[model samples]
Target chain A: MSEWWTYRPSSFLLFSARTYYRLFELYNAEIWPWQVLALLVGVAILVLLRKPGTWQGRTISALLAASWLWVAWAYLYSRYASINWMATYFAAAFALEALLLIVLGVGHGLVWRPPAAWISRAGIGLATFAVALQPLIGPLVGRSWSQVEVFAVAPDPTVVGTLGVLVLASGWPKWLLLPIPILWCLVSGATAWVMQSPDAALMPAAAALVIVAGGGSVLSRMAPARDASGTPALD
Target chain B: MDEIIKAPPLSRRRLLGALVATGAAAAVGPRISAAQPDAIITRPIPSTDEKLPAVGLGSWITFNVGYDDVARASCAEVMRDFFEAGGRLIDSSPMYGSSQATIGYGLYTLGKPPALFSADKVWTSPGSRGPPQIEVSRKQWNVPRFDLLQVHNLLAWKEHLPTLFAMKASGQLRYVGITTSEGRRHRDFEQIMRTQPLDFVQVSYNVLDREAEARILPLAQERGMAVIINRPFRQGALIDRVARHPLPSWAGEIGCVSWAQLLLKFIIAHPAVTCAIPATTRPAHARENVGAARGPLPDKVMRQRIESLVEQL
Candidate 1:
């Protein structure tokens, strides 16, 4: 019990950094041609978000759900759990996020409706950065491109990209979805910062962009949840 | 063994060479430390006549510095101080992040001592994952085998303990044990200790928490399983608590100078304890921790007096 309090925050951050750095190599080796499939899926989501017919919206949500499940199984349950036991809880959280995304985003027909405001523009920009620009971040910071972070593959960028889209979406109660993404960002950012990696800035910067784009305000105005009729849902 | 310190800066080849010649070769069973003339007081493993230094080092969060170069170097220095002070039995768990790796690095840099007892834990689920976790831990620790492999916190022990026993039978490891610190799972731990074919058992024991004294310690003594006492200073809480009050006037009677020594001396004083691993990141504190290993240990009367003083404080 006393040992629990004796932990220095740096110890945790340090563990996070080391874990992430190792993951970069492990993931890249594990997913190669699949990377092409993921990239195409990411591109498809963006294209669908631009036009967002009912089918397109459902397809985009389905794609995000698939990504979350993949990461949960591949990274958390199968790999990270071997190094740290707490990864089981992390996997559970990602699995929960996947289920929620399916229920709220797909079932409810939530779609990206990037408004013509700075916040929307910035939010879209963050979303784009998480998918496209974020991969280039490692190279710019002198990290090899081989270790580039990809959306739907890595936890950090996936959360960031999700936040950016949530903040910009026309959907109500995206506030309902902020907890997991926000938690993941804080977690990944702390890990990267402690490791002194370039990706450290990605999560925090995405978080700030979402807040500026009215993520929190929209969340505050929205109830914890809503029904099809737009009233707060009762248990 | 002396040739390690007398040798030049170690390369991977040199590390492997020293390992093949000294560390790995000499680690058949418990070997006495000649690094320091008066080896730290030791207790025997009842199953095997292996005598372990009563003071070991625990790699909890203190040694889990990930890949931070500076922090890793600090760990190496701590290990160096520990080695010079007649310490052995460096314990770690996979749950502690990069601690096993840090210990590997420290051992590589310091050149493994014959007295070095690499103790680590396999912490994962499902019996199948045990072998892989052990493999990873070995790679991280840069050793082919560990002296003692424990099931951390008794997670999946029934599933994992058999794997450990098989490994021990095959000579991949020397001893098998289970560890639960901070008094989390004593009932289960007691069951394992009482019934299982274990060589050692680690649990939280200090002047502050004497719950172990009532049963666990006595059971260990009776069953003849070597006991590794952890959380010796209550993770520095007891030390801080005692430091607030003056050191008892009878401090030197057990060769105590610092608060750390006082607390450690109390735990190591137990006849049941084969070792008390008090972890620290700083070299100076490591030195202070190892200091308790030397000189006269507190007798039973001294142990009671020290515990009472600490409880009052």
Candidate 2:
């Protein structure tokens, strides 16, 4: 089989999502062979980055394919009769998580295998910025965010802004990372109080908690492991 | 290979039953005679008295099979069989991916059946329903004057109803209805049924799903509006559940050869239900579904049996 045929599951998922989004926008569904072909290309690129003769590459590739399959299955299930918009929304969220897992697994596959280049670094930066800005830009520009006839601009910056700042500060010294989670929690909690949707509030609160808990473990590991001159032993 | 061939053959008694069932189908296999061209069970339009087939094709997941030449050809064949079998009302919408196009292709290929009852919808949020969206939907379906148009899922019902009414008055549309499925928006469904002068109401009511019976069915009956039942098999979940079990002996009494007939009979048994649209992709499935329209429907006792059997699942 050709490389494109190997990633059939990913192609199906991309095709389904694109079909749904197109149907939602245009009120007519059209065949999107190109979208399916594009997803196959993405899977091929991810697979090519893996080391040869290693189980890690095979495992990561399988995971990517499985995630895409799950996303496609979820999308199909959501389209069934008797499911509401809320259920559909949650199913779509699961699809997004599956996509994120593919990204993370692909990133892990490339880790320590090759020397990181400026282009790779810039790509990572771009991805990080996009992920961090989702909540900030989503509430403002996202068509689904508000109920009003005329689009209402978001009045307050979201918890994503705080996370974006923290990600930007991650390039600096370890001490700078300490206050980021604290600031994130305060802003997120305040936003949670103001937002109409519980989902909107819950997301930021959950992100804040993850940052604090995960960051604390990293801080504890860094503290005693530092050398006498206050530089990290690994460095 | 020797081990694989070890299974025994069926007994003579079982073989006889299969022959009998096949014979029964063959007896009723022919199309309606010229004397009764409208032989299929048809319910009337509330206002105009135009009778549509009691069993219509629901094109949801089936029509979304997409751009595959073989699949498209098969769909066209199924549709041709449907129309040749005296099917008139072809239900579709923008919600189902490429369903409208598939229906269009089938109708176009078959030279457009004279009594084509084209029904399509507009799915939008509340207060966003406007002429622009309606016009776009009209162009998408490629129908100059839709025979029956419905507001999809009560989407912007307040805004769209007036537009539909205006279109009806101006002869842009023949009839107008509002549809809500899955029993999600019953409150809105009830409100429309009570307030609006609708010709039909589409809902999800199957042998497995009886939620629509409480208020929607009775209200439609009382208001003298036609009712269309969507998801008659609960989107194939009911079929999967019933597959393991044998067809009850009593089901044969009602002339039901398969579970599809039994389920569809239950929906049509309701005087309120004008038609039930159950979607299928396979040609065999389509033939089986359309076969439901034939033969005697289940009476009160058999309907109770169906309800109990579905409840057991």
Candidate 3:
């Protein structure tokens, strides 16, 4: 048998760039008007991101949970899986992410820190892009408006939006919520790269942005920890 | 052995060669059809002496269109062109997402062209599930019975081969075989080829990818197994590369107008190969591919020359 490393990214592509994009066209047409509902949900999540409180956090989390569950069933399971065998596993991951959002984000009510000034700006920027700007990128790149990938309705924007929200909230929520979206960005980015899509850089760019922006805060917080003697301790 | 060595129509092939030499072959333009004397070129299945067209259709990435009415209708047009050009043998697998359904749509659109030599694969786990998976594939293609059923990529071949053998034994299938692509698992593939009563074995082979020539091709000849060549253009990469260079001056001798035909002819010209299935989305390309099967094939010396030239490019 050939070793796993023998495979290239192109080896896994079972459909063409045209076919992959046409899937979104067919899917978007099949579930009409739901795109508006999904957009409203994105708007709600953004609104709650600004009102920093326990109930607000829980509301944001619940909205995200519903968004993810909807994507898991409506897009990944029903539409994308028809062209990609790996989408079934992606749907399961989305469902798992939704479950985590419900249990950790909604039930426990994550703590929202007034993020470090730059981090807060970055978070709002990313959230805005995910909900609003990303959809327009599809149409700008010559794809029909019907094929536009919307927030919460498509995996790319959903994952990016979740990352933006996670950046605004602090603590263990990042540890639980960040990995799936980060991993999904990498997967979706690679898929776009293989398909030679114009938005090939967007997902990976989002991932890198979160890692640098999100990871920097963690390091900064770690730097402040000291012994009672007012000296840093060595491990 | 004699059944596999049928000669091309000398008189008509010479006429095609003459047209190519005169630079008039460009005007032939989808004129090749079953009604023409040299339109259909067939080779015998070694085990059964059943004739299959030299070129067949493969549905890898090309026909995986999922409910896109435009793409599905385009796929149907490709099928229409393929059948009109005297081609049969459409190959697909469950691993190819929605391809079976797309083919079903095409077949339904074409009224399930009687010339279709339906080829599909059994791909699933536990070996016990193979039969049900094949049934699902059968329903997807909407065919009464597949003309050939292969164990895809040698996945669970030890368990699935027996199921295929039993099906063949009971006359539920016309032929049984195994398949692998991109030059994988040749050692295990050979073991099955040697031990099993296989009618056909599909493998990846092209002008650039010749790893199969070392052992697989010779072994197939030795075992009397008809060979089906897959990835004849390395999923279009090889053709795209060679298309950059001009066709060799000697191409007209064999009536090949484009590099796709040359690459496909190189594969199907092998004595052990019964067919080479190259997938394409355009109806014009489908007709062009079937055109490769007609006219004279390269001899041993010319085959070596063609290989050497392609390697340098």
Best by the DockQ measure? 3
List of clashing residue pairs for candidate 1: none
Candidate 1, residue B20: Cα displacement in angstroms equals: 38
lDDT of 3 at B275: 92
- Whose lDDT is higher: candidate 2's or candidate 3's? 3
Which lDDT tens digits does candidate 2 get at residues A1-235? Answer: 1234333221222122223222222211232333344344334433443333334544433443353344334232334211122324434543443344344433333222211233233323322332334333444544342221110011112123222222222222213322433443444344334332333454455455445533553465456556679877775
Candidate 1: residue B208 Cα off by (Å) = 0.9
lDDT of 1 at B86: 62
Least accurate 10 contiguous residues by lDDT in model 1 chain A: A9-18
Model 1: per-residue Cα lDDT over A83-140, one tens digit each:
5557788999999998988998889877566554665667667767778977777778
What is the per-residue lDDT of model 2 for residues B87-171, given as tens digits with 9 covering 90 to 100? Answer: 6677877666556767777777788777677877766665465566557656655667688778887777888888888889998
| Candidate 1 lDDT tens digits, B60-98 | 767766545677898999998787666878999887876
Q: Give the candidate order by descending DockQ.
A: 3, 1, 2
Candidate 2, after superposition: displacement of residue A234 in Å? 12
Q: What does candidate 3's lDDT look like per residue over A126-184, in tens digits?
A: 99899999999989998888789999898899889988888877887668888999999
Order of quality (lDDT): 3, 1, 2
Which pairs clash (backbone N, Cα, C closer than 3 Å) in model 2? none
Which lDDT value does model 2 have at B243? Answer: 77
Q: What is the C-alpha lDDT of each candidate?
A: 0.75, 0.56, 0.86
Best candidate, TM-score: 3
